[model samples]
Target: MSQWFQLGLQNGNSPLMEQLTFFHDHALLIVVLITSIVTFFLSAIFVNKFLHRYLLDGQMIETIWTVLPALILIVIALPSIRLLYLIDEINNPALTLKVTGHQWYWSYEYSDFNDIQFDSYMIPTNELEQGMYRLLDVDNRVPLPFNQPVRLMITSDDVLHSWAVPSFGIKMDAVPGRLNQSSLMINLPGVFYGQCSEICGAGHSFMPIVVESISSGEFLKWLESQI
Candidate 1:
């Protein structure tokens, strides 16, 4: 399971993101199927009838349509609620990383690693190296071990900013004077990218987030270097 993670948008290299992608793909297919079935039958029944002379009154059809959609919504809500609860849950994490959003930069603190701190700055477009994304690359990347459960505690130094990584299926807001927490079990090994979602200041567009997932041995080496 740990060997298949490749860097991309849909293919999640992290456990939490993999689960989220699977849920999103499967649940969305179910919704589309339900919608298609209802639409096909409704169109088949009403298209010819309305064209001919409207055999059924509009009011009667409207009532059925409204009630049927309501019933379909009930079916969709069940799985959605379950996934939401699962996301809200926080398990016993091995490490905790605290992130604080500043005006135009992101500061990361490895709370468990002798209080190691760093600031991540975005690499400018003109200075992007080979295979590097222009606005997505950062000077310092957060490093963590693969196949480990890591918790994040987030807050803001100024206004509101959101920490979001699409492939990781993780997004949390950093609000002023308030702390928010989330956890992720990154099973796959690779790098993931995110950005500041909220507009705080003029340089908000320059801040970026990078998370590097490495093997346990590599993680320990990186930790030692930080100390």
Candidate 2:
């Protein structure tokens, strides 16, 4: 869960997220440099009385402005395009989880295991226990093994929805009558939370996602118990 006063992005739990954070910093640095330079020029224009008559139609100044902006855009676009392709790239996933979004809740099916399916409902605030996060905790959690590739097949039962997890850098739409797929690989063992980004129905805020990453041995034990 994000705090009210927090302005920065959450610490990432996966490799993609780490790369995204780096890109964010890189873009911010470029923006800051551009802003500083523009501010300095504006201040100089207003404070300094030295005005050259040719400054208005200076060809060199115009050419430098156009070429500099183009070069800056190229610098920004290269890494951005690379990161876009990296996010879309999918490796061999060891497990596939089918996620279905309802009007108010999320249901998951692990077809890789025989008949393992469950619905995840948000835990009511009154029923929440100690250390539980309000509106973020769920009655059922989708578990995945850490350091392994997992693919999610997402779709909606009724209306449109979106499965978004910030730490994983994944946001895929769940449209009715259509199936969408995304991949995730969590390197650390912990709980990651998300929600339906698209507003679907009255209980839109009640639908939350909780993913619990654990060891492969524990995941196998859970699978056996489900069977």
Model 2, residue pairs in steric clash: none
Best by lDDT: 2
Tens digits of per-residue lDDT for model 2 on 115-138?
A: 899999999998999999888999
Expressed as tens digits, the lDDT of each residue in 1-227 for candidate 1 is 11256543455766677777776776688788988987997888866544534435577777877898788677777767877887778888888999999888899998987769988889888888999887888988988888888889999998999998777778899999999998887768888888888887888888888999899899888888877
Q: Candidate 1 — what's its lDDT? A: 0.82
- Alpha-carbon error at 127 in model 1, in Å? 3.0
lDDT of 2: 0.91
**Best candidate per TM-score, number?**
2
Residues forming the 10-long window of minimal summed lDDT in candidate 1: 1-10
TM-score of 1: 0.82
* Candidate 2 to truth, TM: 0.96
